[model samples]
Target chain A: MPQIFRRGRFWIQLGVVVALMAFGGLLINNITVNLIRTGLGLDFGWLWRPAGFALAETALPYAPTDSYAWALVIGWMNSLKVILVGLLLATMLGVAAGAARSSRNRLLRSLSGGYVALIRQVPLLLQLLFWYFVAFLGLPDTPVGGLIHFSNQGIRLLGLNLSVEFCSVLTGLVVFTGASIAEIVRGGINAVSLGQWEAFRSLGLLEGVGLRRIVLPQALPAILPALTSQFLNLAKNSTLAIAVGYADLYAVSDTTITQTGRAIEGFLLLLLSFLLLNLLISGGMALMNGAVLGRLQRSR
Target chain B: MNRWLDRWLTLMLLALLGWAGWSCLHWLWRGADWTVVVTNLPLYAVGSYPEAERWRPLLCIVAVVVLIVITLLGTRHGEWRRSLPLLWSAMAPLGIWLLAGGLGLSPVGTQSWGGFSLTLLLTAGSGLLALPLGIVLALGRRSDLPVLRGGSTAYIELMRAIPLIAVLFFGQLLIPLFLPPGVEINRVLRAVVAFALFAAAYIAEDVRGGLQAIPPTQREAAAVLGLSPRQSLQLVVLPQALRVALPSLTNQAVGLLQNTSLMAILGLVELLGISRSLLANPAFIGRYLEVYIWLAAVYWLACTAMALLARHLEIQLDPVRSAR
Candidate 1:
């Protein structure tokens, strides 16, 4: 009888269910009382009203007279812009640095190692502040005719327009996250066995060819998962755009809250937007991962 | 030997170096001033903490250093390991009293606690608080009860999905609304709570990985020894799990330490905030480069030290490595 009382799934389930229900009711009651006392109800209807604040660099055509919902959407677009650009730049820099860390060239290897150590050790927010307040802001107020031009074909193809806010945020995110991705890349590369490199050398392949053809393909398995997480991290870290007064989602939400006094709504929107953005990134990456695995399986 | 290719690479590297050298020289000549940074070193270190009470923070720093040294040394012996938790908890209150001063010392408000000391305090406080809370949450997520598992999973996922900046904003803005009228929380405490909650999610995930690594047979063995599920978990499972989780947990802790800089957004003048405020001063108008360089160097040193300490602990905790 004692054994039955202790081990019975039915009794245990019933107890847990009842306890959870009671706890949930208590939490709801407390929240309701708090809301009533504060004279703020849970209606999101206030989002339809005017935002009344202008964003500095918005992807969409936004005015001070736009609805709060549109303003939030503009914030979302701005965040997306930064994340997309930041991810591309960070990956490029990370891959280059990661390669440099293992290069035969002594100076390149040491420089990359030093960079990874220094950047990764410092806080990202601090680094962002450095890029903004120091590097970008310190640039002599946009040379005589605003945008400086380097008309070389390569420079033209790269399309480097140094807008202060965009450049600062991009540079900061790239440097900070690039350092992390470099470590991941290095780890991924190192994870490939030495025997494979030996096999490539035996086939009379150059070092570069060996890495590109043999090592990196195997390294992709280790790299992809870390790279995917870094993408999510980059998207989330874009929220630090607030610190530099950049018009990203969190910055726009801050403005919306200050202008409209709708903290709950604005914050909820901010949370949901980031959550959804990350979910999309994670989902897309998972699909890519599946495809990669399928290809590898077929080859096997 | 690939002489021709090597020669081309060397020439290209030389050109790159020459360009970099020229740029460095130009920046030093035209873009930087160190006078402002030299003058404001004290202000950056302790912020506006009163001159008379400066020694209080210094003392707190000394105490913290002593505690850390003791804890590191304590790990070598088994008996000391058992008392380490109690020692840490005791140090928390003692350190708080020494810094804040209510027991035979002067009272220094959290506002006065800024700069590097405050940065360290926030990191240590949040890291310590988050570890146990995260363990509980991880265990709850792995619990057999559907409701408990679901609730824990939701909390962890929600926290993970959102940015720390958003979490800080929630703490700064929404938490006040939830609190009853005439009750208040300090800005420092709010920032700490936000950091702790944010870090707990990551810690929970790390711990879950550790928990999953533990074999099911361990639990079965504990059960055969007449242990209840809870007892088996506490005695048989958690110790091994925590050992496995230590490296990842340390990584999370180091990450949390670096992240405490975000509290600057909440208007708490930690190390980074002081640097920002220094740049805003009229006297330091164009010296952003100098100020930032100094701040980065300090932050880098501290973070590197923590990373090294974590590595040391990782080695010590592993029986194979320790035996070597």
Candidate 2:
């Protein structure tokens, strides 16, 4: 009976393998036929072709004469620029709001709670549009303290000319992601024992100092994992920059695909780029995790 | 010192809130023109469906609303609670049948499907498809077969690595190419497929977490009770795992509903899409603040409702509470 059961399992596994292979083959065959019919075979030769479309925002100097590959690289830099900055600002806002959730002050706790509840409910795209059309674009042409210039056209802060599109995308991402991060941070802080907070207070440490030194360090391990995923989410959400006409990687790929009519190639390149981006984020987080864990262990 | 600081912070917050509330009230009274939302109410609800046939989508939406209310209210009634899942599961097919039409009614093209109805359709359709696919992938990842495990892991990881918009974009572009020359799928179908594919990866991970939480004793007990492995899995394991996973799955469902708005960018007239078109109208131009505020309220209410429904189910499924 046992032998029969083993044979049955093997047969079932074999059947699954066969079925999957056959399905895969049929799809591949259809793709090949469709490609041939359309005269669009998969190839990467378009990478060297000059992308004639102009970008609204480029981190590195770029022109319409640049190769598609070069255009993509510039868009990537633009993506990196917004993502890194958004991550930093979001973390600051999130940590502040998250810590405030547990504050003794009723106003502070409810304010942060309201922020998280309200922001998390709305879609990010709507918020991005709100920021772009209603908030940033509605700004009057006035300079604040003669250092920051605000107008419907664009913002100029400390001699940095920021496009309305970039500002809106960055603001939307930070605000939206900050709410999520705040939740994670609150959960992390909550996971720490009441005894720890009491112990620190008994030691006569100040509330702020005790939180920074005693409570936060302990919450770091729990917070870091969720924080990494949120950072990755922000990276992924950065692709929504396209909605506001920001010349991010996905937007550039979209234009390249439309102009060159190389949907397959463009898609493959996008998948590869995003995979690389995800790896970079997770890899960096892993390193941080290691360093923090090491320090925590040694201190123990 | 702490008392002073707390008092200062409270005063500052109160002043800011008061000013903001006053400004909002002023704008609401004077500056805002809500005719954009008021006049386009039908368009926002059903989106360009033939005026006579608009009732189909409307009825579907009303049915869903009613069902949600009923489920929320009837959770404590044991017999009625058992049928709620069946009714909920029936919604997607019922929606498709009502909206797509065929046997007894005029078939509406997917192009005509838009507005909040379309958003609901997309969420329900993708969610219905993803749940089973995700469950299978989760089980496969933990299976004894090496080939199955590796394949499932690879697919889930690869899918999760990419952003959702790329998947949806390519689904619109590549799905047709992958199909036979004469075969075709509508854009709505394509979007649903893409969403399901993307969501399944995340769902699989959540389900896997739930599965890992189950103890080996349950399986051993099932076997001792003379149940076959398949029966044991279907009868004893999956239900408990899914119950454990209900909260995260609810989050995914809410996220899916919010994400259907991304279809607006791809040119489908879901909730946000309809608003975009409405805002672009010459008359409603520059009414972004009013339109966005309306959209935010709708989304917030919808999401809150979903969270509440899930909480109700969670309570219903709680073994300890049920035992009481």
Candidate 3:
């Protein structure tokens, strides 16, 4: 009976593998036939072609005459720039708002609660449009002390100039993702014991110091895992920069594919780039998590 | 000093709130024109579905609203409560039939399907398809067979790693290439397939989380009861696991609805897509604020309604609560 059961399992596994291969083969055969019919067989020589479309913003020097590969690299850098800055700003906003939710002040708690409720309910794309068309574009052209400038065209703070598209995408991503991260932070903090809060109070620790030194440290293990996922989500959501014409990685890829009509090759490149991005993010978080756990263990 | 600090913070917050409220009120009264939303109500709801046939999508929306009200209000009644799941399951088919319209009414081409109806169809259609596919993937990942486990894990991780717009874009561009030369799918169907494929990966993770929460003894107990493994899964394990997954699944459903707006970029005239074209028209050219605010409110309400319905289902499915 045991031998028969083992044989049945082996056969089932074999069947599944064979079926998958057959389905895959059929799809590939069709793709080859379609490619031949359309005369667009897969090729990467287009990457060397000049990309004629102008980018609204670039972190590195770029022009319409640049190679498609160069344009894509610039776009990837732009994505990385926004994502890193957005992650930092969002974490600050999220932690502040999340801590506010647990603050002793009733108004502060309700305000943060309201923020999360309002932000989470609306679609991020709509908010991005709002920030672009209504908020940033509606700004009056005003120069402040030769140090800062705000206008319908763009914004300048200190020595840095920012386009309306980039500003809107950043603001939208920060606000939308901040709301989710706030929820995660709040949940993580809540997991810390009521006793911990009381213990800190009894010791007469200042609210900021207690939260920073005591409560938050204990909450890190729980918060870090959820926070990692939220960070991944923010990275993914940054692609919506396309809707606002921010020239992020996906937007550039979209334009490239449209111009060259190389959908499969473009998609493959996009996929590989994203997989690398995801690995970089999750790997960084894993390191932080290990450090946090190590420190916590050492202290104990 | 601490008391003074608290009072100062309160005053500052209050002042900021007051200014924001005043500005919002001023915008509503004088700075905003809502005629953009008011004038295009039909277009927003049915998206230029033939003027004569607007009633089909309207009826479908009305049916859904009525069903929601009935389920919320009538779930206490025994027979009505028992039939609620059936009615909910029937909605997607009913919606498709009403909008597609071949049985007794004129059949409308998908090109004419747009607005809120298309949005609802995309969400419901993809969701209905994704749920079962997700369950199978989750089971496969948890399967003892090495090939099944590795394949399912690879698919889920790969799908999750890519951004959704990329998936939808390729779905529009490349779905044709994968099919036999003569066989083709419409844009709406392609979008649905892509959405389902993308969403199933996320849903499988949620279901896996729920599956892991179930105690091992439940399966052992089922075995002791002489139940086959299939029967044990179908009867004992899956029901409990799904119930445990209900809240997270609700989040996915809401996320799916919001993500449907991504379809607008691919040129399907769902709610946001219809609005995008309307905004492009010379007349409504600069009325982005009014249109966007209206869209935001519509999405918020729809998402809230979904959340409430899911909460109701969660309560209904609770063994302790239902026992009462």
**How high is the CA lDDT of each candidate model?**
0.80, 0.92, 0.92
Identify the superior model by DockQ, candidate 1 or candidate 3.
3
Please give the TM-score that candidate 2 achieves against the real structure. Answer: 0.98
Name the runs in model 3 displaced over 4 angstroms. Answer: A1-7
**Better candidate by lDDT, 1 or 3:** 3
Task: Please report how far candidate 2 places residue A83 from its true position, in Å.
Answer: 0.8
Q: Which stretches in model 1 have alpha-carbon errors above 4 Å?
A: A1-31, A140-162, B1-32, B66-89, B224-228, B321-324
User: Which lDDT tens digits does candidate 3 get at residues A1-300?
Assistant: 011123479899999999999999999999999999999988999999899999888888999999999999999999999999999999999999998999988888999999999899888888898998889999999999999999998999997989999899999999999999899889989999999999998999988789999999998899899899889999998999998889999999999999999999999999999999999999999999999999999999
Query: Model 3 shows how many backbone clashes?
Result: 0
- Candidate 1: which docking quality band? acceptable
**Residue pairs with backbone atoms closer than 3 Å in model 3 (clashes):** none
Worst 10 residues of 1 chain B by lDDT: B67-76
Candidate 3 positional error at B41, Å: 0.7
Give one digit per residue, the lDDT tens place, for model 2 in A201-297.
8998878888889888999999999999899999999999899999999999999998888999999899999899999999999999999999999
lDDT by residue for model 3 (B14-66), tens = 99999999999999999898888999999999897999999999999999989
Structural similarity to truth (TM-score) of each candidate: 0.90, 0.98, 0.98
TM-score of chain B of 3: 0.98
List native contact recovery per candidate, as a fraction of 1: 0.58, 0.71, 0.69
Error of 3 at A113 (Å): 0.5
Supply candidate 1's per-residue lDDT for B114: 84
